[model samples]
Target chain A: MRWDFASVFDNTDALLVGAAGTLRIFAICLVLGLSLGLLVGLGRYSRNRWLHIPATIFVEFFRNTPVLVQILWFYFALPILLPFQISPLAAASLGISLNSAAFSAEIYRGGIQSIETGQWDGARALGMRWGQAMRRIILPQALKRMLPALTNRAIEIFKMSTLASAVAYVELLQQGKLIASLNYNPIEAYTAVAVIFFVFLWPLVQFSYFLERRLRRDE
Target chain B: MAYQWDFSPVLANAPLLVEGLVNTLRITGTALVFGVALGLGLALLRLSPRRYLSWPAGFVIEVFRTTPPLVQLFWFFFAMPILVGIEMTPFMAGAVTFSIQSASFFAEVFRAGIQSIERGQWDGARALGMRHDQAMRRIILPQAVKRMIPAFMERAIELMKTTTLIATISYADLLFAANEVSQKTFRPLETYTVVALIYFVVIFLASQVARLVELRLARSGESTVH
Candidate 1:
């Protein structure tokens, strides 16, 4: 019943590397997912069915399925389908971003919808092109409303980066699992990782709350 | 560039996949019932006036909610027996962790739903000389329950997807069975594609149902809810 963190401390370098791997994937997915999501979000708002239907399907397929399953599918199926090999790290990143892109698209769509139709029409009335209107008027307003939700989603994908461990990407949880099994002390290892994650993520969670309150006050 | 795209290997192993799917539902359903009840209790504790009662519950709920459920799954599956001196089967560990994780989320949903009720309703109940418990039970909950339905179902869909994490610990879940079959048959593409399709269909249907419920509630003028 005695807890020993000595074994965990001994492996701090490995865990740090693992945490670095997680952050790397998190950073990659955050950029790719949100960018792709923005495109898809625009597609969702487009008048053309060509854009709308496909965007909706993409969002629905990724959002409905579990990210773990999606990761496995990417790790296994994509290489075969492409007739080329994908490194596991790339596969995991692709999977996570695609999954996150689905949610991001919806979040973006919601933000856009939250804007009044009158503001949209007013932009047109002001002799602005669609792109100019969006960039100048609609976006400035929607981004403020959407910042908190988007940050929350970003934090979510950051936590989800741990699932890369399932694909053998050697992220934080995998590092901890290996160490725990090696040292015959699963409790200590998991406890260490839990504390690490809490310390790392608690700030983001706090910031998300602050954003939520600030947004509420603005309303 | 010619891939055969054979699916016979996966089709031959349909029974195992079905069993795994059923197991997935079982885990999610069991977790949902207990999680929601425990969540309601946690919400009550959090709403209690006494800090001694609410603070600990609030802290636990926040920690669980913020942390990844996958890590929690690992801790419960690997660390719990060592810490508590109680041996838990893989399924039991999965169920317990998911229950706790889902409870944390549901607590927030319930709290939000309760808080979304207008203050005038509380004032009206007070003016009528109704006790707090009576007002909550008789006046507030009926309305809140209706609002909670769409959100609860959405969480249920999310919870169903999350149950797949149990496969990592070698539980015989749909994804696990698919993995086993693919490994044996050397048809990873076929087996995994089918598994993905199954998940897509199930969750897609659930989301559609949730959307219909939300639309109906909105049509009926119950849209001013959390």
Candidate 2:
């Protein structure tokens, strides 16, 4: 069969809706994943066994498994283990958030560990408590140091959200597939989806570059 | 419905999984070899003084580096046939996609390694009557390749992990086998856990190989440093 660009363009509203859904998932998961990552990162670095073991296991399991499998597990396996049923959207969000947390935890740990010992010592010498020092001094610097990496992770999570389509979530890719199946124009539909990703992703890439340059200048 | 944990069902399908494991390694190994070759070429192209050559190479690097590999893979598998009238088998599609996606990152790694070599080395090689290619072949590349070992190892491990994506397009890799078993046996958790363990083993072995190369490089570096 021949390619049809006109047919794909004719269904622009459907594609736009899918793009909106993708952005929503990305925004929600970014916030949730970063928060979870911070907690787990801090937990992994903590001396408490209660915090460390669980955090380590969480990071290792998610990081090691293929994200598609992890998405499958959340969508299929979790409801069997848990008491409550979850919507596919919720499962997709949770899966992405959890997977991203594993990666972000490592990034945060690296950022936090990169802070000089003298910074902590000085904070403590200034009569700040451990929490006070971490919250007031170490964390601010670490966050700045980590901004570039964190943004990169956010972009990754956004890309990975497309995998949710495999589990039957009507994200951008899923919508593209639907359009392709109906129109029998896989190339144009998928290409359109890719362009949508490119448009959305290009800004994030620029932002990451800007952050990296700014961070280097500050250094 | 109560679920019972049964390893036997998965064990019965071990042969399929084994074949899948072999296929995964085959794809990873082949892609790594070709990817490095392509990457080296691209790196040289980028470092070439000629802007006409380097600019296009640079664009390829950025496009592949920024775009997700899965999307690229789909484009290769799905779009290439329409665009070029050449249909690729799933395995061929996987290999080409992996290699292309990998070349970009490997090119960056190699470029960084090459740049780390001092300019004095180039001048010294020129004074010794070596042609540009000869100088690079005999002097520059040996040192750059050695410095690039760690980064290349890290990328290899990443490539190993990423081979799982091949399963998406129905290549019978370990991940695809796990999905098959999970669907048939309804024990996705166990099937996926086993698949993850197998990946860990493969990646761990790749890491070990990296370590050995690193040690060998260090020994050579020490001898040269003296």
Candidate 3:
């Protein structure tokens, strides 16, 4: 009948460790997912059938399935094919990174496509190669438009770090589980976890919204 | 030695997988219906002229949208029952968590769709002596609902994918079934692969259908809301 956060406060060290673990995976997935997404997005934009087809398939396959399934598959199924077992961090990171890549590829593609054909023509008129033009001219401009969406993706990746706990990874949610079980304070334990997440993510969400509004205003 | 791939064990447990899939769909359907209805209510309250109504609705939407669904699920499944002094089944917890989680998302879609309607329609209805509720029901909503369809389908597909998380709470959804089959048959590779493929096929097909609807809406010259 009484709400007590004292137990949760006493376990601050555990939560801090969990926060570090969550941030580690989030950073790994964010960098890997978004950077790789640029390549896959380019592939989707490519005229070459080889590049386009495989990119399409990759995006479709990864985007279509639930990410937890991917993590579990990597953790349980993939080890059988490999010479060694997959670490929880590796499996969770791979699953989240690939899923984010698939989703973010579309964002990248849409951003690139939103650039007018005139931009491409101007780059071509300047004797710039495709890669040079993409890097110097097209992407810089497209990235501005993609900023809101990409930030949204980053927030999503942060939230998804919790799924690492499902594999018994030492993440925020996993640590929360440990604390709750040990202290028998599920209410305080879980509430603290949720509040911690909300504290971390609310600013990012607000930033994305701000970016979206600015983009809308500019356009 | 290369690991040998085997499918016989997974195939032998087709019925279990099927039941798991059915449970998955059941949760998705239950959550989708409630999510949409509650989303509409939330959106309406958010759009209310009164600050008291709009503020609380906005708060709910923001909190739900900002937090991780897994954390929400855990809180509901593990924490809520004891707080309220009642027992909750995994299904109940999953349904409640997903419904509210998805409703927050759907609320935005509804809000955007409603706002996208030209202000002239409302003025026209007013000129025709229609009350606010009457105009909303008869004039505004019909048009907004059409624009919202593509977004609705997209969110529904997302909801289905998200339902997989219930397995972590020991619900016998498709992913949980895969775990069971893998352990029982000692064929984790084949079992997980089959389950993943099943998810891929169903979700991919749903996505394609959503795309088709979106394309059709575009061709019909009806601009849709996200």
Better of 1 and 3 by DockQ: 3
DockQ of each candidate's interface versus the true one? Answer: 0.83, 0.39, 0.94
Instruction: Return the lDDT, model 1, position B27.
Output: 92
Model 1 chain B poorest 10 in a row by lDDT: B217-226
Off by over 4 Å in 3: none
Q: Which stretches of candidate 2 lie over 4 Å from their true place?
A: A1-3, A84-86, B204-226
lDDT at A124, model 1? 95
Name the lDDT of candidate 1: 0.89
Q: Model 1 in CAPRI terms: which quality? A: high
Clashing pairs in 2: none
**Number of the top candidate by TM-score?**
3
lDDT of 2 at B96: 93
TM-score of 1: 0.97
lDDT (C-alpha, whole model) for all candidates: 0.89, 0.84, 0.96
Which candidate's DockQ is highest? 3
Q: After superposition, how far is residue A146 of candidate 2 from its true place, in Å?
A: 1.5
